[model samples]
Each structure stands twice: as structure tokens, then as C-alpha cells.
Target: MQTGNLLLLLLVMIAGAYYLGHRRALILARPLGGIRHLHSLPFYFAMRSAIWSALPALLVLASWLAFENSIIRAVVVGGMAESAQPADPAAMNLVISQIQNVASGAIPASFVSQDVAQAAEQLSRLQNLSGMAMTVVVLVLAMLGSAWAWLQVSPRMRARQKVERVLQTIFMVCATLAILTTVGIVMSVLFESMQFFSKIPVTEFLFGLQWSPQTALRADQVAAQGAFGAIPLFVGTLLISAIALLVAVPVGLMSAIYLAEYAPARVRSFAKPALEVLAGVPTVVYGFFAALTVAPFIRNLGESVGLSVDSESALAAGLVMGVMIIPFVSSLADDVITAVPQALRDGSLGLGATRSETIKKVVFPAALPGIMGGILLAASRAIGETMIVVMAAGLAANLTINPLESVTTITVQIVTLLTGDQEFDSAKTLAAFALGLMLFITTLVMNMVALHIVKKYREQYD
Candidate 1:
């Protein structure tokens, strides 16, 4: 059967089973006259049964779909004669591809022998047969299990509680998976970074001022030896991030204040989302804006002021990144500020404080922790941002603090290191991982500090 037809049939069966379960639940719950006697309504019991029935079969189907190709390939490869197999693995793979193409009718050629053709035909038939059989068996088992569950449903079933518990567990598992994924990524970065550190000393990477990532592609090429110092790149990253923060923090905080404290209901509603439109603008657009508009303006301004300026200055990139981060800071800060107890503001106003005074002295101090948290989060974002720096900030890794000079960042360096033709096991690729690890660590530290500060502030307020 067609895949769509099979899916439709499965869905129909599940729905039919659900209806049957619902009816069974009603029959079982007939003894409970009033709603007060039962933990949940009969339909909830049916829903529980339906979910239990469908979930296992769906899981089986999904797993089968995922692994069936590999299993079929393995079976076909194993059935091939030893003499027929190509000596080289790559050639063997090509032969397997040809066989599969011929079997699927993509290659219009008859098999030299009847045995090979027969085997290919049998393999295809077996795969389809197995998939269909598994689907049917699983569906039947699910229906039977659902029917049994429906039979077990009674006034004392506590179906609602059971269903809720199952859902809560599923949610917890999903959350765990997310957390585990992050941990796995961090671990992978750490491992590769460690491998990099083995070849290049950590001191040179962290404190050395020069940044060059070019390395020899082959062992025989002795001419290429690349510098791996990260200080200049890190300095550039800091410069750009600092610039972004300088632009973002004040504007975002002030905007948040106006929206939370002074704006009228309609104005607040419109302006808040309007401000968020800045956040919605893609970073690539901001990158070109930095490169095309901001960089030239800064260079011209510098030249007019009798200072030499590079076309790709750090100031432009930093300034644009700051603009990008504003909405993030403002939106988050506004929410936390608004969430601050109204009672605190009311009391401050009652004590003969002006509206501005109340906001500055009472509201601002109370919301300071949350505001700091937002700023730190924005800082993390700035530190990690790639496109804006890549486009506007020149690739020259100058260790100078002068924003008018060309500067590079860790992210930009990482991008340059891994791009183009490169070996995975080389120092160049490994350096990318080290930079990633540092970035991860920096963000982690910032987040922890922010969380601690927010917690303390909350404690004081409470």
C-alpha cells in the first residue's frame, strides 16, 4: 500500500479504537450516577485509552522507518558474493549504489545472472512485507491493549490523575533531552579544545596578541606555520560587544521605562511591539547596514576630525550590534519592571513622591536585578553574534582599543578557521573548538552571575 494510504488507515483505526474506548468507558462508569462520585468524566478515560493505544504503535512505526533502510542495506550487502565485492571500500560503495539503482529501476540493465536479480527482487519484496507486517501487528496489539484498558476503567479508575502523571513525565523527559543536548555540545567543544591545547600551548592561545589561523594542509608542506594567539580576536570581540552594550543598554532601559511607567495604554501597546520590530530584523540586514552605512559614516567622521580610520572599523559593527540588542534588553527589562509589585509603586506615590521620583528611586532600584539580568543576557548575545562582525569588522586582528582601527573577533576568527578546504584533525579546526569552549564558558559565567544577582535582589524585595 502507498505510505499515505497506510497512514490514513492507521489514523482511522486509532480514531475508531478511541470511539470504542469512549463507549466502553461510558458503560463502565454507568455505576457512578453523579459527577462527584468519579475522579474524571468518561471521555477523559477514553482519551487516556486512545493515547496509550496510539503512542506505542506510532513509536514503533517511526523507529521502523528510521532503521529500515540501514537494515535492508546491510542484508543486501551481506548477501553479495565475496568475489563480487570491490577491493576498495569506495568502489564497493559505488557497486552497492549501482545495484540498488538497478533494483529500483533507475538503472535500465538486466542482471547478468538470474540469482542476483531474484535476490534483489526478493529483498525489495521482503522489505515491504516486513514493514506492512510490523505495522499490522503493532496496530492489532495497540487495539487489544486499548480494549483491555477500557475494560479496566471504572468509577475508581483515577484515569485523569494517571493521564496527568504520564503527560508530566513526558514533559520532564523533553526538558531533560534539551538539557542533555546542551551538555553534549559543551562536552564535544571541550574535547576538541583539549585536543587543540595539546598541540598549541594554552598560554599562547589566551595571552598572545597576534591571531593567524593558516596552517599546512599536508604533512609534506613545511612552508605553512600559522599563529594561533587569541588575544587580538578576543579584544576585538570585547570592543564590539562593549560598543553594542553602550548603545543597547541605555536606549533599551529608557524605552522599557517609558513603556512601563509613563506611556498611555494604547501608546504602550503599540510602541512595545513597534520597538520589538527591531529585534525581528535579521542580523544579516544589520550586518550590511553596518558595512554600507555605519562604517562609511564613522570613517568620514574620523577623517574630518583629522584621525585616520579604516573602512571596516570596530565602531560601526559594535554600534549596529548594540542596535540589535536593544529590543532584547528593552522587552525583557520592561516585562520584569512591569512584574514588580504595584504595591511598591503605590506606596512610594502615597509617600508624596513625584512620578519620576517614584520610578527612579523606588521602581528602578527594585527592578535593578532584573534589568541587570537582561543586560547580561544581551551581553552574552553580543559576545556570540557572528554576522555583524563578519561583515563590518575587518579581518585584521589588531590588539588596539581604537574603535576606528580594523579589528577581528573570536567568532570571526572561528568562522575563518573552519571555512574553505581544511582537515578536521588539524590545529586550525581544533582552534575553532577552543574558541567555542571559551565562548561557552564566558556565557556560562555571565549567566550564573546574573542569576545570583537576580536571586539576591528578589530576596531583598521579599
Candidate 2:
């Protein structure tokens, strides 16, 4: 049976177990004057049965699926000609890929040796046999667990405690999985970045002015050990992000204040959602708007005023990026502003303060921390944006603050460096990991700054 079909079967069996367990609990209760005779609720008994029936079968299925490929590959490869034995890791991987491709009919068997063709046939047989065995074993274990759990459903059983404990364990397992996944990502990037740093000095990467990552594929090629200095990328990222924040923060904040404070119920209902619709618009659509409409307009206006504007200026990209992130600021700020204590506003009014005065003195201060959070969130969004910038801002890693000039961000360069087929061992490809690590650190610092601001404002309000 296919894995998906087996999973469906397991769920069906679990449902049957739940029904049987619930019915049994009710039958045991009826003779003793209703459900009050039971130790716990009938639902708890049902859930305990369902958990037992599902968990063991899932474990078996998961384990089989995990090791099936490697075990099958080893068996198939063992029967091939002695000359077919892989001499290295890369060769072994290539052989396994080709074998799987032939088995899947992605590659013709006639193209390979008779030995390899036979191995592919063996692989196919083993895969089918493995699937059949897994289906049988999993279904049998599930039934066994279901029968065991159903038999244990009794007037004396602490069904609620058992069910609760099982759920708690499941939650902890999920949380642990999340933490492990995060650690795995960080370690993967860190190790690759270490490989990159081995090839290029840390100081040169951090402080050098040039940002080219192209490397010569041949010894006789003209490409000089392409400069790895990352300063230009950092400067471009900051320059564009600063422009985006300048455009986003004030406009979004004022919109939030007006919506939360001055707008009527009807107006707020329509306007808030209408503004948020901008957030749902895809970033690529914004990129098109910037590139096709905004960039050309900016260039035309610049020429009329005797100023130079690149056809793909940072100004156009930043403006559109700011529009895309407005909802992040407005939505968060509105919630916090509306949450300010009514008593604070009343007290300010009692002290002869007007509506504007109450807003400025009593409400805004209380909401400052949340507003700060919203702006910083927008700033981070600006920093991490790639699609809009890639489409609108030309890929020129120029270290200048001029908004009318074209520039590229670290993310753009990372994508550029790793776009086509390349060797992972090459510095050009490894440089992407280093750029990713630096981006991670930069955002971490930004988060720290946001937290500090939030704490400062929170204390004043408290």
C-alpha cells in the first residue's frame, strides 16, 4: 500500500477504536446508574484509545520510511560488478541516483550494464516488498494497541490523567522538534560560513569596499580572485532600508492613530481592512509596480529637475517596499493604541486636557512601546525584502546614500552568487552562507535594539 493510503487506514482504525472505547465506557456506566459511576469522562476514554492506536503505528511507519532508501540502496549495490563499486562519496552518490532513476523509469535500463539493470529490478522488487511489509506490520500494531487500550477502559481507570499526560508529552515533543530544527539550521549555516572564512580573511570580508564574488573556473581565465569585501552590500542594504523606514513609519503611525482615535465605527471598519489589503498583495506585484511605473516616473521627474536618477533607483524600490509593509505598522499600532486605559484618558480630560491633549499626553505614551515594535518590525521587513528590491533596484552594489542611485542588498547578492549550477566547495557558493550569517547577526542586533526601546518606553508608562 502507498504511504498516504496507509495513513488514511490508520486514521480510520483510530476512529473505530475511539467509538468502541466510548461505547464500552457508556455500557459500563449504565449498569451503575449513569456516567457518574465512571472515574473520568467518556471522551477521555475515547481519546486515550485513539492515542494508543495511532502513536505506535505512526512510529513504525516513520522508522521504516526513514531507513528504507539506504537499506535498499546497500542491498542493490552489493550485487553489482566489482568495478561498479564507488571509489568515493561523490561517485557513490552518483551511482545511487542513477540506480533510482532507472528503477523509477526516468532513465532507460538499456543504457546501463546488465548488472546495473538487474540491480534496478531488484531495487524495484525490494521497494514493493518493503511497502507491503510496512502496511501489514503497521496495521497489526495499531489493532493490537487499540485492543489493549479498549480492554483497559474501565470504571476504575484514570482515563483523564492518562490522556492528559499523553497530550502533554506530544506537545513537549513538538516543542523539542522546533528547537532542534532551529539548532540544525544555525549549525549548518555556521559550518559552511566557517569554510568560507577559511578561504577569505574575516577582516577583508567585513571591511573591504568591493563586493564581487565571481571566481575563475579555469586557471587561465581573466577573473582575479574576485573581491569578497562586503562593505558595499551592507551600505546598500542600510541605505535602502533607511529610505523605506522614512517612508513607512510616519505615514503608517498617523494612519493607525487616526483609525483608532478619530475615525467613526463605519469608517474604521472599511478603511482598516482596505489599508490591510495592501499587505496581501504579493511582493512581486509591488516589484512590477515599482519597476514599470514608479522607477520610470522617478527618472523622468529627476531629469526635468536637472538631477540624475538611475532607471532602477533605490528610491523606487524603497517607496514600494514601504507601501507593502504599511499594514504591519498600522495594524499593530492600532491594536495597542486602542488598548490604552480609558481611565488614563478620563483622568487627563478631568485635568482640563482636550481630546488632542489627552491623546498626546495620556494615550500615545502608553502605546509608545507597541508603536516602536511595529516600526522596527517594518524595518526588519524592509531589511529582509528581496523580490521587490531585485525587480526594482538594479543589482549594483554601490556604497552610496543617494536615493536616486541604483544599489543592491546582501540578499540579492546571495541569490546572485548561488543562482546557477556551481560547486559547493567553491568560495563563490560558500559566500552565500557567510552573507546569510551576517544577515542573521544584523537582524539579531536590530531585535536587541527594538527590545531595549520597548523596555525603556514600558518603564516610563508603568
Candidate 3:
């Protein structure tokens, strides 16, 4: 049976089990005087039955699916003659791919050797047998589990406790999975970065002034050793992010203040959603606006003032990025400012403070931590922005701090480095991972600082 069909069948079985368990619970409760006398409610009994019928079946199904391909492939390969068997891992992979293609009709049996054609047939037969076996096994397990749970159901059964424990365990497992995923990502990046640093010195990658990742992958190919300096990328990222923050912070904060504090209900209702709509617009659209409209305007305006402005200047990218991130800042700031205790505001005013003074001294300080968090989020968003930088700020990797000059960021460089078919063994491809690690560190530091500020002020307020 197909996996989806099996899942649907399992759901039906679980529902039927639930109904049986509930009916039995009610019957037992009637003999015991009432459901109030039972250890748990009928609802918990039903849910316990459903959990029993579903959990074991799902676990078996998942395990079967996880190893089904490898098991079938091994059986098929082992059936082949010794001379026809693959000699290396790469060769085995290639043979497996060919067999799969033939089985799927992407490649005709006549196009491959007789051994491969035979293996494809064997693979198909084993897969069908495995599916049938899996269906039987999963259904039997579900039926047994359901019967056992139904038999155990009684007026005194602690069904609620069992169900709650299962749910708590599931939640713990999910949290562990999340932490493991983050650890896996960090370790992968760290390993690849180590490989990169083995080729290029850490000092050169960090403090040196040039950024060039183009080099030959094979020893026979002629190319530059490639300047691996990342200082230029860091400068570009900071310059653009700083510009974006300068524009976003002031405008978004004022907008939030007006909407949260000054605006009437009707005005806030209409304006808040409209302001936040900018966040939903795709970054690529912002990139196009920057490249086509804002960049040209900046260039023309700069020429009129007799100043040099590159066609793809950091200023153009930063301005458009700032506009794009305005909604992020505004929405977050508005929520935090609105969340400030009304009592604080009332107390400030009761002390004969004017509205402006109350907001400046009382409301602002109370909301400062949250406001700082929003700005950190916005700055992070700005630093990680790739499309706008690529479109508006050309990939020149210039080390100058001038906003009018063309420059590139770490993200843009990472994308450029790993764009097409790349040999991971080469420094060029590994540089992408090194850049990723740097970006991750920068974001982590920003989060740490923001969290510190939040923790320090939150205690005072609480």
C-alpha cells in the first residue's frame, strides 16, 4: 500500500478504536454508578485508545520507510554475479542510480547492460513485496495495540495520566530535535570552516584587506592562489546595515509612537496594517526597485551635485533595504510600546508631568528594552539582506567605507562562491562555509547583547 493510503487507514482504525473505548468506558461507568466515580473521564479513555492504535503503527511505518530503499538496494545488488558487483562506493552509487532510472522508465532496460536490467527488475519486485509486508505488519500492530488498550479500559484505569505522560514525552523529544538541528548546523559549518582555514590562514581570512575566491579546483588547472581576505565584505555589510538602521530606527520608531500613543482608534486600525504590509512584500521586489528606480535617482542626483556615485552604490541598496525593513521595526516597536503598563503613564501624569514628558521619561524607558530588541532584529535583517545588496550594490568587494562606492557583503559573496557546480575540496567552495560561520558569529553576538539589555532592564520593570 502507498504510505498516504496506509496513514489514512491507520486514522480510520484509530477513530474506530476511540469509539469502542469510549463506549466501553461509558458502560463500565454506568455499573459503577456514574462517570464521576471513574478514575478518568470518557474523553481521556477515547484519547488513550487513539494514541495506542496510532503510535506503534506510525513508528513501524516510519522505520520501514526510512530503511526500505537501502535494504531493497542491497538485496538487488547481492543477487548480482560477483563480477557484476560494483567495486567502489562511487561506482555503487552510479550503478544504483542507473538501476533506479531503469526501474522508473527514465532509462529503458535495453539502454543498460543485462546485469543492471536484471537488478532493476529485482529491485521493483522487492519494493512491492516490502510494501505489502509493511502494510500487514503495521495493521497487525495497530489492531493488537487497540485490542489491548480496549481490554485494559476500566472505571479505575488512569487513562488521563498515561495520555498526559505520552504528550509530555513527545514535547520533550520535539524540543531536543530543535536543539540537535542547531548543533548539527553549527558543527557542519565549523568543520567546513576548518577545512577552509587549512588552505587559507585564519589571519588572512579575518584581517587581510582583499576578497577574491576564484581559484582552480584541480592541481593541473592554472589560477590565482586567491586572496581570501574577508575584511572588505565585513566593512560592506556594516556600512549598508548602519545606513539601513539609521533610516529605519527614526522613521519606524516615530510611526510606532504615533500609532500606539497618539493615533485614534480608527486611524490606528487603518494605518497599522497598511504600514506592516511592507514587510510582506518579497525582498526580490525591493531589489528590483532599488536597481531600477532608486539607484538611478541617486546617480542622477549625485551627478547634479557633481559627486561620484557608482551605478550600484551601497547607498542605494541601504536606502531601499531601510524602506523594506521599516515594517519589521514599526510592528515590533508598536507592540512593545503598547504593552507598556498604563499605570506607569497615569502615575507620571498624576505627578503633573506633561504628555510629552511622561512619554519621554516614563513610557520610553519602560519600553526601551523591547525597542532595543526590535532595532537589533532590524539590524540583523539588514545585515543578512542579499538580494537588494546584489542588485543595487554590485559585487566589487571594495574595502572603502564610502557609501557611494560599489561593495559586496558576506551573504552575497557566499552565494557567488557557491553558485554553480563546485568542488568542495577546493578553497573557493569552502570559503562559502567560512563566510557563513562569520555571519553566524556576528548575528550571535548581536543577539547576546540584545538579550543582556533585555534581561537587565526587565528585572527593574518586573
Judging by TM-score against the true structure, name the best candidate. 2
User: How good is model 1 by TM-score?
Assistant: 0.87
TM-score of every model versus the real structure: 0.87, 0.94, 0.94
Residues 42-154 of candidate 3: C-alpha lDDT, one tens digit per residue:
99999999899998999999999999998899889999999999999989999999999999889999999999999999988898899999999999999999999999998
lDDT of candidates 1 onward, in order: 0.84, 0.92, 0.94
Best by lDDT: 3
User: What would you estimate as the lDDT of candidate 1?
Assistant: 0.84
Ranking by lDDT: 3, 2, 1
RMSD of 3: 2.0
Candidate 2 residue lDDT tens string, 1-462: 999998998999999999999999999999999999899999999999999999999998999999998898888998788887788998888888888889999999998877778888999999999999999999999999999999998899999999999999999999999999989988999999999999999999999999888787667888767889999899889988888888888889999999999999999999999999998999999999999999999999999999999999999999999999999899999999999988898899999999999988889989999998898889889999999889999899888889999999999999998898888997889999999999999988988998998999899887
lDDT for 231 in candidate 1 is 87
- Sequence-dependent TM-score of model 2: 0.94
In candidate 2, clashing pairs total 0
Superposed Cα deviation of residue 153, candidate 3 (Å): 2.3
